[model samples]
Target: MAEIVALFLALCVQLLALPVYVLSFLGLWDPFCKKVFFPFFMEKTMVNYNQKMLRHKQDLFRNMMDFADPSGKLSVLELGTGTGTNFQFFPPNCRITCTDPNPHFKERLAKSMAKNKHLEYGNFITTPGEDLSQIPDASVDVVVCTLVLCSVKNVEAVLREICRVLKPGGAFYFLEHVAAERSSWSFFWQQVYRPTWALVFDGCSLTRAIWADIEKASFSEIKLKHIHAPFPWTPIQAHIVGYAVK
Candidate 1:
């Protein structure tokens, strides 16, 4: 069965990561897995999904860019900016500050920056989303996060940091996979595979009700919708995409 195959693949991935687990005590596991192993894994498995969603992602970025002031260059702070995948979608002349907990992504991030020459690089901050202490309060015009909340240690804390860093009336744009409807078949599978999925994918929870936390985060205005993304990975097909005003 397909489920059996999926589980088998997950187990295989865990086995491959066994050496990294052993290196956890030496503080090398997280960096190595995130910067090297995970990117390689995603590139192999997510090509089709990313291709399918390309148009949708483009439209979402266009909409988010509408919030930018036409007369001035935009300032953007991106959380969990893995490989700077969203850089191509940003409007020209925008200054982008990228933040990720794993510092080892610098090499890949630099490569992406080189490719997206339209956008200006503000610098990379090696800090988690929950604690953005290096960025001054109300410093950025827009904050962006994509496929990131599921792995964060505390979503609420990250949301608070987002609100604090954005200027008044600034926007928070996000695209995230979340829990499916409670009674759906996808939800059932999500629950069944969650433990293995989290272990293999660096603690990304397949069943997080992230929209609920966003609602409680008290954004001035929120425009969000749920849709099933065309993901080969069934448990994470349910997704949400939208922007909020701070």
Candidate 2:
């Protein structure tokens, strides 16, 4: 009976991955990935998984909020803000600007914004995380990122962008899934499955040493710690949560 269930689940994965593969090759992966696949992910695994991890990372989230301007008059920019799931965690009345490469997320983001009345929605820029030319230098007070760095082509470039947009003493709060410890069996599995994983998940690399990049960036101070979450959908369970000050 277990073997039968395993085979059935294997078939389901292939069936779901097929459309993503086809759309990727056709160069329409972004819209389809956001419109279809991301929502599917949110419903199937992300919602539940994030709920559990939220408990583990609650203190980190609180620290992020505490860094915000107590007067609720700060500009907060969130890079790679898919569907605006982090909206509820931010402090109320802060100016919120969300940027994502996938334009399709704008609608879903709007829905989330409507529900998150505490956040004052300012802009929804259709820009990738690696570049933030539209935002002025040293103009943002806070930058919030979650589960996003693994997918960018150049983690250094994105970190540089984060540093650029942040005001002096501004805080960058991030929670990213990163490559497992080099000594672990999970690291080996991550390397083996990374290519196909990226193909299906819109270029999300499970092998990025994101914490290392964050540490080496021009941040004045970094308070980060490693963590692990056991989620069956992906092998990249190792994570880091922290805040960096510019």
Candidate 3:
């Protein structure tokens, strides 16, 4: 219905936007990433839209927390911490290690990170999901992925890595915008829009069945709760927030 139409229109916008982005990037007309990617998405993306969704995503992660080490001793590792939006929510007793692939935003990430200096120890590592083998197994109590898995280079490896790092009962909490429920019109728009969308955003695929893949990664205690973003429905952009216990 309306969602299908919007998806198709969004596809058209992406198709036309590709060349414009290339020409602009080449002409030294660099558009600040904040315009389309970072800041813009923080407001426009499904997970970040309603103020309630923000808290809800946090609550989902907090549920996994076991503060055995007191306020300053517990550690949480967050993936794709772009502009590091989730940093402020951590308890003063907790330290957070965050990672992202976009080195271009180091300064901005650092600036945002400064606020958390009072916390015992916090680190922002420049890395991607594939390289997470370095994090020790059973080390992190909570792994938070907020609107992040869509763009990762290797989804399968990342999930395995998350499982490896998580303590036996640790949780994998996420807020993701996933592939639309199947429909002719919705499917058509997603196919058409995918190429352009992938180019502008990080190789994010609109068609990936993220939930199924997460379960396929061999997580035994999987919990899925489907809900919509409190806005216009776009098939591939609907918000789903839930956690999987390891």
- The lDDT values for all models are 0.84, 0.80, 0.69
Which window of ten consecutive residues has the lowest lDDT sum in model 2? 1-10
Could you give candidate 2's per-residue lDDT for residues 1-246 as a string of tens digits? Answer: 544554565456556678766777798976776678776675366567668787755676675555556574778899988878887777665888899887776767778888999778887898998889999999988998888898888889999999999989899999988989887767766765665577777788888888889989999999998888767556868988889999
> Sorted by lDDT, highest first, which candidate order results?
1, 2, 3
In candidate 1, stretches whose alpha carbon ends up further than 4 angstroms from where it belongs are 1-32, 43-47
Q: Write the per-residue lDDT of candidate 1 for residues 1-246, one digit (tens) a residue.
A: 656765776667657767655677578866777878887775455446567778777877786555566667789999998778788789886899999887776877788899999999988998999999999998888999999999999999999999999988899999999999887778767866776567657789998999999999959999898988987657888999988999
Judging by lDDT, tell me the better candidate of 2 and 3.
Answer: 2
Best by TM-score: 1
**Per model, how many backbone clashes are there?**
0, 0, 2
Task: Locate the minimum summed-lDDT window of 10 residues in model 1.
Answer: 41-50
**In model 3, which range of ten residues has the least summed lDDT?**
63-72
Ranking by TM-score: 1, 2, 3
TM-score of each: 0.86, 0.85, 0.78
lDDT of 1: 0.84
lDDT of 3 by residue, 23-92 (tens): 5568632355534455445535433553556666566656444533444366778898776666666666
CA-only RMSD, every prediction: 3.9, 4.9, 4.3
Pick the winner on TM-score between candidates 1 and 3. Answer: 1
Which candidate achieves the best lDDT against the true structure?
A: 1
